[model samples]
Target: MSDLIDDPREGANEPEFTVSEISTAVKRTIEGTFDHVRIRGEVGRVVHARSGHLYFDIKDDRSVLGCTAWKGQVARLSVMPEEGMEIIATGRLTTFPNQSKYQMNVQDVAVAGEGALMAMLEKRKKKLAAEGLFDPARKQQIPFLPEVIGVITSPTGAVIRDILHRLRDRFPRKVLIWPVAVQGERCAPEVTRAIDGFNAFTAGGALPRPDLIIVARGGGSIEDLWGFNEESVARAAAASGIPLISAVGHETDTTLIDFASDLRAPTPTAAAELAVPVRAELLARLEEIESRRISAMRTALNYRGEKLRDLSRALPRVDALTAGAQQRLDLAAARLPGALTARVDRGRAALSEASGALRPSLLARTINSARERSEDRGKRLAPALERSSAAAQGDLARITKRFDTLSLAPQIDRRNDALAQLMRRFKQATEVAHSQRARKLDALDRLRLTLGYKATLERGFAVVRSAKGEVLTSTKLAKAHAVLDIEFADGTLSIGAKKTARPSASVSKKGTQGSLF
Candidate 1:
């Protein structure tokens, strides 16, 4: 229902129109005054009419208004609209007759303040480039096999959903979410806080450091998307130890954060695609590479095979050269056995001839020599016996003559002379025999001393014999309770052996000597 304004000066003089008339007139006045009216708002309850018309609400913090756009106008949008899309609509105001409502007939619809966003983004890009943040030198490479990935984005937003979906599909890895407001006045600080928090968390060893960071959000109006353009956000991204990939807006949209980041991607999903390689496409490429590698290997193998075949063909010549050597060997091999047999036969024949020729003559000569030696010995023995008999007879005759003469001349004087001569001869014979017997006795005494065991002990030494009759020189040979016979010059004495004392304890100095003997 519409209410009419009251006039204070002429309350009764004014004529009252119907609510519809007032609303229609008002709508007409507004449409006529403004050639184009543009209003910015967030899209809500958006509905596409079947009649090629789109109906939605333009809303802000204070108010909401109805809006409609023809399909022709909607076609110009680079993106599809869902709830909470910020947009600017330029159209004339109109009123619905049946519903009695004011609504906008949008001639043109576009994202609001994108020019400002672009201009700011370009300026920031230049600024960051000057600061070397946007320079390629500052960009870090994302690890192909990262253990963990850090995501700086809205806790509950479509961007996260897209990212998780892509990451799960491409490659599943640990993802740590540092939730932050992505679109608001509080978004910059939250984003900066998240970057710092992630860095701190990694530094404290509570979490593994991120190999890559994804700073992303869904598409929005320039104002809603302004958080990514903040200097703090850019610096945070630039200073993040990890490599950063910025994904903020639709494919056609670009932001200052994108420039500052190591890599820029148009959309959250595209960013995910960039972060990880597609498994199917990568496998296909690997297979292609493997195929090419195998082809190269086969080509190399074939070349080597051809070279081997050429070498194999030349082997016959080598074999022919070797054949001459084989022939010489064969000739040697054939002649060796016959030559050996002939040499053996010759040796045997020579040995047989020598044996045959030497045996009879050697026997005959040996027999003749034996006979001649026997006859010569017989002749010598006969002559020696005859000369020995003659010498015996002459000695007997001389003895007889001396005896006879002595008998005849002997009287008292003769007897006395003979007796003196005999005495002198007897004395000389006794002296000579006594001398020879003394020498013999001395030789026999030396022999007896050498053979006697008592001879060793007679020289101021003791012969210590063990019970087993072995000579015990060392005390180690006689244990405790062992009976040993100590043979000295006078007698043999038996004593029981005792354990030998240790060297250190048994030893004494000159002045500190004790009697133990």
Candidate 2:
């Protein structure tokens, strides 16, 4: 109906255009004029679009400004705008023609001031704490004496110097300095990388991996030390494989990394002190302990010697102890000769009394009586044997006649057929058992191949072995062997080291090996 009605004043002296044309012109004009600008405002409603775009309103008491950050730009934002948070947005301003609105296309974002930064820091701290990053259970105990200490800090700063000096004064140890920016924009990422780089090292490699890591920075304002407050830096500290000691800023100045680290130091100098004890003091204490041990040992020996002397004094003399046994032995010796003589006389008298019973005539009579009895028994046994043989022969002759009379061919044939049938069944059962065992053997072979490490060698991996055919699991162990066998997918490689001296199993040394086996 509105399209049908025509205006009477269609042609006028003033210039005119369509709504789209005017909007396009306005869009171009506004974008050209305010191509780049920074706007500081308090964040209002924020919308994280499903398409990875961030839409939000920045408003003050009077007016509101619309801001948007696309997916590509959102990741680069130092501070992601949150509700009720103040932020300074840096981007180009452009108007939307269709919607008849103007919006700021945010390229970067940051907290407006220290207050906002503190607010963000507090919020992040709460979030990370809720995730248990700061839990005491996750904190690792510091090594009593770390052989290698990795220091992460700026190379040009006196903080690292102070740490090294303090470490030198206390203890001498290997220090791996990972130079990184300790302040400003590059600080967080560089520090994080330093931590990860230290952790990536393999033990006993060409470069010795650190037993402990120290992240350090000098004292400064919150803004100067903001890098340690970054979430990435804190998470890196928490996730460090090596135990990390955070020594950033002064004692009173706490950062997020301090909470996530295994230990916190008041200053960079203090971190070194925590790493190890003073060498001179340790030596002195050891000497004192050794002195105490020697003194105690001497005291024990003296006490034992006194007790032994007292016991010896209380003991009877050797001659006194043997006197009673010697007297008794002498008494027995005096009676032994007379007793032996009496025994001999009694034996002679007994022999004389029994001499008459062993005469020649008496022996001859006894032999004749035994011979007569033996001859009678032999005659009776021969007759019994003859009668039993005759009876056996008669029975055998009778059974032979009965066997000849019966037909035995059919029973013999039946027995043969049954035997053949049993043989056939046994053969079939043997075949079935053999087949089952063969299948099981094949399955076992496949399982062995699957479980073996050779198949995995094709995937850019190799199995390292010592010359003694042992699988070397660690670099230190591999280095211990002069010859290494590296098995790849295609073949095996045997390589020799510069110095190939295989250690002997015999622990025997001249006066050094212990007496106990």
Candidate 3:
């Protein structure tokens, strides 16, 4: 029986084992042999499982290797595996007993080399570009001087220091640092969150929304700055409501963020410079503008004053205008006295003639006697007097016709009165138009001041917001957030400080993760 048990065909020489036992032995052998290996192959057929596990194939020309990355491992991957990409995967080889298959337990994945990385980056770029994420029309114009600036970078990096120093030298501005990982897998996501957070601020928050954003990193290799090349980071940049400046790597180092950003800076320090103008230069410019405005106002006033003086000089004096009328009145008065004297003399002479004619001696003389007397004294004088009496009797009869003519002096006076009425109407119309235009300009200036948001902030009010920048209007909302930001007229203050202030970190931010491989 022992000889039978030791038979080669039965168990001893060939080895006898159950399926589970054999699988275990194989798993151990493979795991031990390929433990902590660095394998390079082209990625193929990637599957992102619903349970946050990853399954994929990596192959050379002839052989294929299956790989698996757990949920935890996925987070550490520098670049997720994509089909046809050449990658260097670090992990251990293992076998599954149930499926009778061998695979790699991948801890991380990286593009095989710079060439492969560049190729992948180029592909991603093309894809994002096709979606119009890089359109210039989608870009916001950078504020000439941002009141608040949000910076995303590593908390501990020299990049932040350089940025701060440069900003201090140029124009000092309020900066809110969103600490993040500037590299590694966390970099892209962290940067994306920082951008979203800045945008989430209440329009009227005490911690006001950033007018500008800067995504900055110091000079580094392409591999070191790979986080900025992420599609998510690029998309976030494109979607930013605030104007964004990208300052990743050195002057020659380019990333997808640079393309999507409103502006691109060569370095982190350069980005600070781009964010604000020189303080002294701005002050000088403002002073010059104020001076110009004052000068222009003074010049206009002087011109108007001189023009008014000229008009006044050209106008006839009140006394001069009345002089002609006064002289005419004087002449009329002088003529009136002389004419009255003449009229009195004529009346007396007429009365004397009538009295003489009515005398008894004259009346007693008949026409024949009067005629004989006239011929004796002066027949011509008597005949002439009789003829003049006969003519006056005829003229009196004729004078009874043709009455009702308007006099010249009264007609001329009416014409002058009508002219005066027209002059008054014209003066009123001109003055009315001038006043309306003046009011319109004044109203426009008033409207500009009234509608400005800065004017409202200056009124001693504050806006309550969470550190994430969401407006917390009530106590309940405030309770949900660990930290709070209060925006004041001058600046922002943080309360219930959950996140301690720290230096910068590598760029990265928040969201429901989709796929890591």
- For model 3, the stretches where C-alpha displacement exceeds 4 angstroms are 1-15, 294-318, 328-517
Per-residue accuracy of model 3 over 130-191 as CA lDDT, tens digit each: 99999888988999999999999888989999888988999889899999998878889999
Instruction: Score candidate 1 by lDDT.
Output: 0.79
Off by over 4 Å in 2: 1-11, 130-132, 174-179, 193-210, 239-241, 311-317, 359-517
Model 1, 1-517: lDDT tens digits are: 2357655675677888998788778778877876479888877888988888788898999998898777887754333344666777788787777787778888766555666346545656777778887777877887776668899888787789889999999977789998888876568888888887776664548678777888889887777877777787889888887778888898776667887788888898988888887777879999999999999999999999999999888777767779999999999999999999999999999999988867888889989999999999998999899999999999999999888778565487788999999999999999999999999999999999987866876777787788777887665565533677777899877766543233455556643422111
Indicate which candidate wins on lDDT. 2
Give the range where candidate 2 is weakest over 10 consecutive residues by summed lDDT: 508-517
Which whole-number lDDT from 0 to 100 does residue 322 have in model 3?
100
Q: What C-alpha lDDT values do all the predictions have?
A: 0.79, 0.90, 0.87
Window of ten residues with lowest summed lDDT in model 3:
508-517
RMSD of 3: 35.5
